[model samples]
Target: MLETDRLILRRFHKDDWQDLYEYLSDEAVVRYEPYGAFTEEECKQAAISRANQEFFWAICLKERGGEVDPIAQAAGKLIGNIYFQQQNPPDFMCWSLGYVLNPRYQGQGYATESCQAIMEHGFTKMHVRRIAAMCNPENTPSWRLLERLGLRREGHFIKHKFFKRDAKGNPLWTDTYLYAMLAEEWPVK
Candidate 1:
């Protein structure tokens, strides 16, 4: 588990399925995501699948009062998630980052905090040499967050992503921007 001042990044649990569904089921939240919105069953499966992964983390809000307690940890509300998947051969030491957050929790800087923690972990503990992330070009907030995290915008793929179907059942193709950072470029704080 990883802790920030106001958040805890821990592995997903079966009990987190409902909380994940709350956002995963929202079309607005998942519109830019490749998988789009998910059904309750899919959310449950996702929770279970992610729980088995080493790099996925459920972003939870730390309990108040600045005191560590088991009950508080158990009761901590899940607000988002962050993950990094190895993207290349073991010798390459590369990873891809992804994240999602509850819409109600937007504009709160939680995404940035959670991403920073995960990126640091990936670079230092996981021995990752490079990390990359991508988002729809129109997802201003998302790309902006990537920029704020010091990831350099490397490429913009035009009409390369077939995200989902529109109301007319036509494939929805969107442009994507890729951001990346090298371990050597990341400041060690």
Candidate 2:
């Protein structure tokens, strides 16, 4: 598990389905994502599935002070998740980073904090040589978050891919903005 000032980046647990459903069920939260809003059952399976995956980290708010109940403190709300997975051949030492956050937690620095921690872990502990991220050109918040994490805007692909289909079964192509950072470029913390 990784801890930031007010966040905890930990692995998902099957029982976290409720909190998982909280944000995943919101259409706005999944707007730019490949998948649409999730159903409760899908979230239940997702939490279980994510629990078995080593790359996904559940982002939780660190409960503060001594006024809260012990159980509540132990089980923080799962605001979202961070996906940091190693790319092809293990020899590549490259990884891809992605994230999804609840709109309620938007405008705060939790996303940046969790991502920074993951990047640090990847570089220092995982020995990752490079990390890359991609997002729709229209997702300004996503690309901006990438920049805040110090990743350089590397490329802009035109009509790169499509995640969803239209009512007529036509592909909805979208442009992508790629960002990357090398281990050597990471700031010493």
Candidate 3:
């Protein structure tokens, strides 16, 4: 598990289905995502699936008090998730980063904090040589967050892919902005 002053990044648990449903069910939250809002049952399966995947991290809020309690903090609300996965070819030493957060918990720096923690973990512990992220061109907030994390905007692909279909069941193609950072380019903090 990884800890920040206000957050904890740990493997997902099957019991976190309820918290997963809270955000995954919101259309606005999943707007830029590949899939549409998820049903409760989908969230349940998602939680279980995430629990079995090492790349997915459950971003939880750390309980605050006079003295931080690890046990209580571990039970804190599951506000979001971080997807940090190694790309193909083990010799490449590259990884991909992605994230989603509860709309209610946004506007604060939780997403930033959680992402930074994961990037730090990838760079220092996992020996990741490079990390990349992709976001829809229309997702300003998401790309902005990527910039805040110090990833350089590398490319812009036109009609890259489609996640959802149109009213007539046609593909809704969208542009994508690719962002990446090399280990040597990582800000020395």
Best-performing candidate as measured by lDDT: 3
Q: Mind giving the per-residue lDDT tens digits that candidate 3 earns over 1-189?
A: 999999989999999999999999999999999888999999999999999999999999886333565677778888999999999998999999999999988989999999999989898888999999999989998999999999999999999999999899999999999999999886644
For model 3 the TM-score comes to 0.95
- TM-score of each model, paired residue for residue: 0.91, 0.94, 0.95
lDDT per residue, candidate 1, 1-189, as tens digits?
A: 888878989988987899999999999998788777889999999999999998788999886344654686646888888878998587999999989999988898999998999888888898999999999989899899999899999999999879688899998888889999999988633
User: Global lDDT of each model?
Assistant: 0.87, 0.90, 0.92
Please tell me which model should have the higher lDDT, number 1 or number 2: 2
User: Measured by TM-score, how close is model 2 to the native structure?
Assistant: 0.94
